[model samples]
Structure formats: structure tokens, C-alpha cells
Target: MKVMGFAGWSGSGKTTLVEQVISVLTARGYAVSLVKHAHHSFDIDHAGKDSWRHRQAGCREVMVSSGQRWSLTRELRGAPEATLDELLDKLGPCDVVLVEGFKRAEIPKIEVHRAVVTEPLLFPEDGRIVAVATDTEVSTTLPTLDINDPEAVADFVVGYLAL
Candidate 1:
């Protein structure tokens, strides 16, 4: 599978661009998977739920199933957070994987930048950034795409990776 990523500072509209990219790419018959990195602790299970109870009861991992869908939750239990490659192994086959974080990872990615923001561009420090999507006009030599237009970004991505 082709692994691509979107990297940016907080509040840079990375999610918005990523969502549109997913919509556009999937509509064109590409099987896309995503891995999003969160900055803080998060919980998908609610208190008093069966899955929650299982974890609280000292279960290392819990698998819940129903007619609609099945999910597996595993507790790290002091184990360090998994690396990008380790997390990617858990996913099934796909044509592309869109990673929202892990900007430091060694993968080709697009740096999303907002016009009003003052944060510096990440491409200068990262060689893996093949292109950039920005809300304003940038003079960098790297290929630039409009952050507001996902179609153009998708087209650029497809051409860049020959997907």
C-alpha cells in the first residue's frame, strides 16, 4: 500500500483538508485507510459499558462483537506507544493509508499550512514532504496546492505517487 501523510501544526485545518481528500479519493475508486494521532488521552468506550468493565476488571485486551460491527480494544499496560509501522500492521490491505500525524516519520507527506497562521513551513526541515497545501500563496520551490481545493490536491497526489 502507498503510505502518505498530512502534517501541520495544531489548528491548521489539517482535518478539513484530509476529509475532503478522502472523499475525493474514495469517489475515484481508491481504497483508503487512515491513522490519526491524538495529542491527549482519549476513550471510545463509555463508563459502565461491558467493554469498559472488562478493561477495568484487569483484562489486557477485549473484543466486542455484535451484528452491526465488532471492535477490539487493547490496553498498553505500561507498554510504550506503538510506532507507525507497528500500528500499520494492524490494518488490512488497502491502496493508500492517510496518516494525520507522525510528521517525523519517514514517509512522503504534504504539509498543510493556513494563511493567517504564523507558524513556519515544515518542508524545509523534512525531506519527505513531497508537496504542500496552503491557504495562501507561498513562494517555496516545493509543489504547492490550494488548501481549500481538495480536488487539485487529490490530482496532485495521484500523479505524484502514480496511484
Candidate 2:
């Protein structure tokens, strides 16, 4: 499977662009999977839920299944977080994997930038950044894409990966 990433500071519209790109790619008949890296502690299970209770009871992992969908949640239990490669190995087969973070990863990535954010651009230091998607013009030799146009971004990804 092919892999690509979107890296940006918070509120830079990375998630929104990724979400729209997923819709575009899937609509084009490609199976797409995503791996999002959360900087803070987060939980998919809610308090008092059966699955949550299972985790609270020290279960290493819990699987929740329903007619519509199923999910497996594993507690790291203080172990180091898994790396991008390890997480990729856990995903089912897909045409492409759209990663939401892991900015330092060496994989090909698109730097999402918003002029309003005070944070400096990442492409300057990140050799992995293949292009930039921004709401405003920026000074860069890399290909600049309109952040609001996910279709264009999707096209760029397809061409870049030759998928």
C-alpha cells in the first residue's frame, strides 16, 4: 500500500483537508485508511460504558463489535507508543494510507499552512514535505496548493504516489 502524510500546526485545517481528501479518494474507488497521531491522552471509550469498564478492569485489549462496525482498543499500560511503521502494519489492506500527524516521519508529506497561525512553516526544515497546501500564498519552491480545494490536493497525492 502507498503512504502519504499531512503535517501542520493545530487549527491549520489539516484534519479538514484530510477528511475531504478521503472522500475524494474513496469516491474514485480507492480504499483509503487513516492513522492519526494524538499529542495528548485521548480515549475512544466513554466512562461507564461496558468497553470502558473492561479497560478500567486492566484488560490489555478490548474489542467492541456491532452489526455496523467493530473496533479494537488496546491499552499501552505505560509502554512506549508504537511507531508509524508499526501502526501501518496493523492496518488492513488499502490503496493508500493518509497519516494525520507524525510530522518528523520520513514519509512523503504535504505541509498544510495557514497564514494566520503564528507558527513557522514546517517545509523549511522538513525534507519529507513534498508540497504545501495553504489558505494564503507563501514563498516556497515546493508546489503550492489551495488548501480549500481538496480535489486538487487529492490529485496531487495521486500523481505524487503514482497511485
Candidate 3:
């Protein structure tokens, strides 16, 4: 499956832009999946939930399912964090996989940027950042996309991927 990523600093609205692109891509009949890298610990299950209870009881993996949908939560315990390629391997296959982080990964990516953020632009230092999506104007030789315009961004990605 083709893979792309949205790399940016905190508060740069990477998540929001990814969401929009997902909507646009899916609407166009593409089977898209996303893998987001969180810098901090996160929780998908809450207290009193069966999945949470199973996890609390030390289950290695807790899969909760119903007629509507299901989720499989695996506890890494003390295992080393999986690499980006390893995570991608677990996704089976699809038209595209929108990765929301892993800025250093050697995959093509769109750098979501907000000039207001203090961090410098990533494309300069990261060769994988082949495109830039931003709200304000920025000068760059690479293709520039409208971070606020999902359709335009989607169009660029689709065209780039020739999908």
C-alpha cells in the first residue's frame, strides 16, 4: 500500500488536517488507514470498561467487539516501541496509509506547518518531507498545499501518488 505522513510540531493542527484528508480520500472510494504516533502515554479504554478491566488484569491483548465494530488493544508492557515500518506491516493493505507522525521516517510526507509555532520548518532538514501544507504563505521549491483546504491537499496527494 502507498504510505504518506503528516509531520509537524505540537499545535500545528496535524491531526485536524489528517482528518480532513481522510474524509476526502475515503469519499473518493479509497480504503485508507491511519497510524498516529503519540508522544505521551494515551488511553483508549476507560475504568469499568471490560477492555480496561482485561488490560488491568494483565492481559497481553484485549479485543473488544460487537455487531457494530471492534478494537484490539495490545499492551506493550515493557517491550520496546515498534518502528514505523513494523507498524505499517501490521495494517494489511490499502490504497494509502496516512501516518500522523514519525517525522524522521524515510517515507514521503507532507509537513503540516503553522508559522505561529516556534519550531522551524521540517522540510529543510528532512528530505522525506516532499510537500508543505500551511495556512500562511511560505516560499519553497516543493509543492505548497493549503492546510485549510482538504480538497486541494487531497488532490495534490492523489495526483502525487497517481492514485
Top candidate by TM-score:
2
State the displacement of the C-alpha of residue 40, model 1, in Å, after optimal TM-score superposition: 1.0
TM-score of each: 0.94, 0.98, 0.96
Report the C-alpha lDDT of model 1 over 38-122, residue by residue, as the tens digit: 8887777999998999999999999999999888888988999989999899998988899998889899999999977688889
For residues 18-40, write the lDDT of model 2, one tens digit per residue. 99999999999999999999999
lDDT of 1 at 150: 98
Cα lDDT of model 3 by residue, 22-119, tens digit: 99999999999999999998889999988899999999999888999888888999999999988998886799999998999889999999989889
Better of 1 and 2 by lDDT: 2
For each of the candidates, give the backbone clash count: 0, 0, 0
Best by lDDT: 2
Report lDDT per candidate.
0.91, 0.96, 0.92
